[model samples]
Target: MSQGRTTEGVRDQRAELAEANHVLVDQGILDGFGHVSVRSAEDPDTFLLARNLAPGLVQPEDVQVFTLQGETDDPRKPYLERYIHSEIYRARPDVRAVVHSHSPAVIPFGVSTVPLRPILHMAGFLAPRVPVFEARDTLGSGSDLLVGTAASGAALAEVLGDAAVVLMRGHGFTSVATSIPEVVYRAVYTGVNARVQAEALRLGECTYLSDEEAAATVATNTPQIGRAWQYWRDRTA
Candidate 1:
């Protein structure tokens, strides 16, 4: 793609991602915290992400182009403690998009010794394993040290493995996929799974899906994530 076209593609993805980000914020996924990032269509060395804007109010221009490996060239533009996004993109070539958020329920498993297993059909994606990156010592929310250091961020990426998401201990989550919609899809499921798991713990022993069963279940989730995207377009259009 030409530079302009590539930039346009990133911008387009940014708009779509931002729109989905708006959905997350509206549904209470993010506040001023959290961010959505997509690998730049033009160059892998670059990626697109929201700057200091609220996910609910993101605009095209508000999406910033950033180098995936280092500090941004411009000082005026405040880059997100962006390692969570960049490091994962660098480590997982299969992932084209990522969403990091500070959702409330998801935090329980992130900090607690308890695991956030797949207690619902929507969370079958996490059947194999979900790592609570027990790498942090202290901090508040996703603003933890993972975002501050590239090495820690890479450690965060390693925890994800082939899984769709990873919980940064004492922090939040970093969800990845081949597209913005996929990440958003997983994001919704991530929260839904947490809600179900929390409720299940209270009720009784919740049945968990095995690897094969979970993989098979993923194939059957036809309109799950796609519906999440459309749900936004329909409501926001």
Candidate 2:
């Protein structure tokens, strides 16, 4: 459905997406539940994500195409939280990839008033403060925390706004970025930063990266993201 998009290019994109799944799982950013997606290279209005399979189990053939509205022609079941990727790509034109994960280290910040801040240069993308999305406000009370509907997903995107990551209350976190590697980088470092921040808090009052420092570090580190990606890819292999 993508005009002038080569079959080989699409195949390569599928392979890259599948590799992302393995990379995230290997980095502990994703488990049996989380997912990652890339905006279709040939079609901005669509994205590519693995089917209902676990991230560590996803292969190129398990990847499927999904519209920004989260529709897909494939009969196989999609992740119920696929809307997390669809609405993010829809809301943020600059974000070409999305990651939704129930990362353990970052879970407490989402539920408590404690804010998740950038404690390390690798996670400078989380500077300022991470916004937390409350599903109850959008879906009413007693709702499952999953972003299953378009409206709920859109609400989460609204909270995500211009930030690199948004935490879901009592759930997990969703990260967005300009590419798959970048989003994976953010997701992984965010968890690490959370763990470090919690330890610092346990000791005493903690210091965090200033906005200017965070910006500067992000500029310095982004180009080297490939190093981390390659290492994770090899580990997964």
The numbered model that scores best in lDDT is: 2
**Cα-based TM-score, every candidate:** 0.89, 0.97
Model 2, runs deviating above 4 Å: 1-5
lDDT of 1: 0.77
Q: Rate the local accuracy (lDDT) of all candidates.
A: 0.77, 0.91
lDDT of 1 by residue, 1-237 (tens): 587886677668777867877877876667877888888767787778877777777876777777767456555555556887888888888888898888888999987777988877777888788877776433344443556677767777787877888987667888888877778778878888998888888887778888787887888884466876788656755
Model 2 residue 31 distance off true place after TM-score fit, in angstroms:
1.1
1-237 per-residue lDDT for model 2 (tens digits) = 544457777898899888999988888988888999999888899999999999989999999999999999999999999999999888999999999999999999998878999988888899877999999999999898889999999999999999999999989999999988898899999899999999999999888899999999999999999998888888877
